[model samples]
Target: MKRGKKYVEAAKAIDRGTLYDVAEAVSLVKKTAVAKFDETIEAHIRTGCDGRHADQQIRGAVVLPHGTGKKVRILVFAKDAKADEAKAAGADYVGGEELIPKIQNENWFEFDVVVATPDMMGVVGRLGRVLGPKGLMPNPKAGTVTMDVTKAIQDIKAGKIEYRLDKTNIIHVPVGKASFTEEQLTDNFQTLIDAINKARPSAVKGQFLKSVTLTSTMGPGVKINPIKVM
Candidate 1:
């Protein structure tokens, strides 16, 4: 496979030590180069850390450089003033009384995130049975419930990724693609790490961060030295 000139140029600019650190951070399990191939050359780093907890639990937020390559359908529950405010803010779905039943009937998971105004807590509270189990219920602690409907919608639409600590207390998310330039990936990786470190809960005594690793969908894992980023 022929590497793109841009990729080659990007690769050349990487400092060896920084590359090694990134390789460790991203956990590049396998490195291979095809002599003759039709596809573009790409590499994936797999970290040796389990992110199931991060994926399933770990409630925190991050704004992606490249918005979540998906359209986020927003549902807002507000009344009178805030209701109109949410709609004016460009929420895909907006309502008060009709919100719960609509969520119960339709596939609520279809939406990326749900936001509710302060007054809508009552409506949001009632749907706990339906939304809680799926981890879709908006919580005040997670900043999903706010009086700032405009900010909420804009932030979410801009690529905010939410994670919560589960029973195990681990958080995992895709930082970037193999096709991304090293610099681009590094920036994204740094942003995510910063978000995670700041998410450490006071209740979590001792090792707030047990260990860190970066891996791909299907790749070997590498252990990242947390100090490198600090």
Candidate 2:
């Protein structure tokens, strides 16, 4: 768990006890990105909900206003017209069960996102044991499992990202890159926060957002004021 010198230097810039405003946090994240390569900016939101409870689970997707800077490769699980639609909409790869072997035997996973048509879920189910753990398994709640292959592919290509609470109820997502303007990063951050707020489950009685932190790929986390975000 030894951090590099660059990371240690960057960590010194942030006040460990302070909760920064969204804009300030975004700016601090950009400033602390000392890596030679344009590092990706990520948001980590700790929520009060417990993922073990079905009713408290938080899972959904949102189209970042200033899309995630990384290019998203989409793998569509479809057949016939739907498959064609997916390709026409700029899907990186489109196929049905035939892909199972390529993925299983060859260990091929070139795509960043997985989209499957509702009818094709049966075929997709076979790969669940592999895809589920990787967070590649498409679900209806995330709009990855749907009949609208074209829309799904387009959205993903347009910087749409899915966010869901992990085992500890923290949702980690890429907001943008360090190369982006502070304004762009702020916009994407706000959009994501708004979406998460709207998705709050009625079952949660205490604070919905426990803590929100923004940081670059190799930088120290800058905590955001949860009250300000809410």
Give the runs in model 1 whose Cα sits over 4 Å from its true position.
1-20, 23-58, 106-108, 177-179, 202-205, 218-222
Highest lDDT: give the candidate number.
2
lDDT of 1 by residue, 116-203 (tens): 8877788789888888877778877667899998888888887676766544445556565555555555666777777766755444
What lDDT does candidate 2 reach at residue 151?
85
Candidate 2 regions exceeding 4 Å error are none
Question: Global CA lDDT of candidate 2, please?
Answer: 0.93
What value does the lDDT take at residue 6 in candidate 1? 42
lDDT of 2 by residue, 1-230 (tens): 99999999889889999999998899899999999999999999999998899999999999998889888889999999999999899998999999999998898999999999989999999998888989999999999999998888878878899999999899999999999999999999999999999999999989999999998988999999999999
lDDT of 1 at 189: 70
lDDT of each: 0.61, 0.93
User: Which 10 successive residues of model 2 have the least lDDT summed?
Assistant: 150-159
